[model samples]
Target: MLYRAPHKTAVDPDTGELFTDLLVIVVPDDSAKSALVEDPSVPFFTVPHFDGYNAVLVQESRLGEISRDELEEILIDAWAARAPKELVAEFFADQ
Candidate 1:
């Protein structure tokens, strides 16, 4: 595990108050998850519940570790994995 914390903080749009919330889960591709974990700078982890061992918990604090292009590629793969085949094909028609 890269790091663990009790909760994350966010601001309330209405009152400008801070509140705690659980970490968000991102279901990226297995290969992408493995690649991210292998890089020490990227903070990615697995959970025992819904994510099991295959998915990752992306910490907002460590988002700087990944490059924008790298992240976009990984996310596209993740989305394609769950998206309809026809949709994916249409999106990547030129490729």
Candidate 2:
């Protein structure tokens, strides 16, 4: 999500209007993206942005294709990549 100061806007790409239903998930690494792509059952893809490096898009409709366990791991890694090391260690210590 774009943390642009005071106001956070979710603009629709097609109409250039604000939208509230979108979810932007930042992937942890290329390895995660590669794994997702390799799995034929799951619908995951990376885009040309950031030189097609790191970020992956998980389609809203096909979110169910990925299992709960897999999703948890992915989210954990994603947060870990961005969050502070001490916080990550404390939070995920028992996990």
Candidate 3:
């Protein structure tokens, strides 16, 4: 997969440096088309699309070093953080 710098700027409070080399994978409709980062040592995150089938994967270049469980946790958190609150409310409104 191709690696491009994230256009959005969000400072890492702990590092205090401009994050430059993170990866973002945007899947269209079907998750099958998604791209995977080969490395297993970097931090990773993901955002599931509102429709549920698509998602965006964000991660550091060295995700290979991180444990699978940790990566999954980060991805789930990112997915929750990225989801639109209003949309989520609508989905849960009937419950």
Candidate 4:
């Protein structure tokens, strides 16, 4: 899902435009810290203004640094976190 930051939190230093290479994924609380610690190589950061919010901003352009399987797992976890229970269950059943 596209997360429009309440304010412009991401700006490209070079082009000085809103960064287009970003993907905001909702996750469980405190997941951001663990995600960063788990893979420091991946550019993951939490919005300080969003202290209670459970989401992480990932550099979409840097996703290539991770394996396809890892990306799929991240996407699945994000989807399952917000998807309706029935839909999630159905999706897993088909898998």
Candidate 5:
């Protein structure tokens, strides 16, 4: 399942300011969950549930503040690491 936090923040740079949205993705399976939690690149927080799933957080900032391409690449990398192949394919196929 996918979850999102209500918090939003902005990154400011010489060009302008960029707003970011936070998100959390919960995947089923212990190994995948562990892999995601261990990855240092993505910012994540563990949920309090006893289930094997984990929560991965990501932020979206403006192009001027931080390249949108880079932000999306980070999100995709984390999502692929945590989510099952089928789930990832399905999510992206629709988009």
Candidate 6:
């Protein structure tokens, strides 16, 4: 799922961009870890509050680092992580 930050929750260390202008996505734990490790060039970060939940904050300005297909995959995975199993199964079955 994607949501806008109500305040300046996250910031980009390099460019000083804030999360208030971006969208946060809740992903699977493995995916979150993999994104942090495998895609170090991308500025992905999280807060302590998100310790147990698998999520990451990304600056909208930095979205160029990921391709359209990658974004689509992330969105689908995020949705599946939150959606009911039956809905996810039906969604995939349609594909």
Best by TM-score: 6
Per-model CA lDDT versus the true structure: 0.58, 0.62, 0.48, 0.69, 0.51, 0.72
Off by over 4 Å in 2: 1-23, 50-52
TM-score of 3: 0.32
Please provide, for model 2 over 1-95, each residue's C-alpha lDDT reduced to its tens digit, 9 standing for 90 to 100: 32122113434457775434334556677776687667788666543443356655555656687788877787787788789999999998877
- lDDT per residue (tens digit) for residues 1-95 in model 3: 23545444434447776457656544333432233323334443443222353444554656676678865654544454457888656655755
Better of 2 and 4 by lDDT: 4
Please give, for residues 1-95, the per-residue lDDT of candidate 1 as tens digits: 22335432334346665423324434545666667657677665544442344456665666677799866776677677678999999999967
List, residue by residue over 18-48, the lDDT tens digit for candidate 6: 5466567888776665666357776666766
**TM-score-better candidate, 3 vs 6:** 6
lDDT of 2: 0.62
Q: Report model 2's TM-score to 2 decimal places.
A: 0.65
Ranking by lDDT: 6, 4, 2, 1, 5, 3
TM-score of each: 0.58, 0.65, 0.32, 0.70, 0.35, 0.72
Which candidate gets the maximum lDDT versus the true structure? Answer: 6
Q: Give the Cα error of residue 57 in candidate 1, in Å.
A: 1.0
Of candidate 3, the 10-residue stretch with the lowest lDDT total is 31-40
Model 6 alpha-carbon drift over 4 Å, by segment: 6-9, 15-18, 34-38
Please provide, for model 4 over 8-67, each residue's C-alpha lDDT reduced to its tens digit, 9 standing for 90 to 100.
766665777776667787774576446653567766666565467777776677778878
Best of the two (1, 5) by lDDT: 1
Model 5 regions more than 4 Å off: 1-3, 7-20, 49-51, 60-95
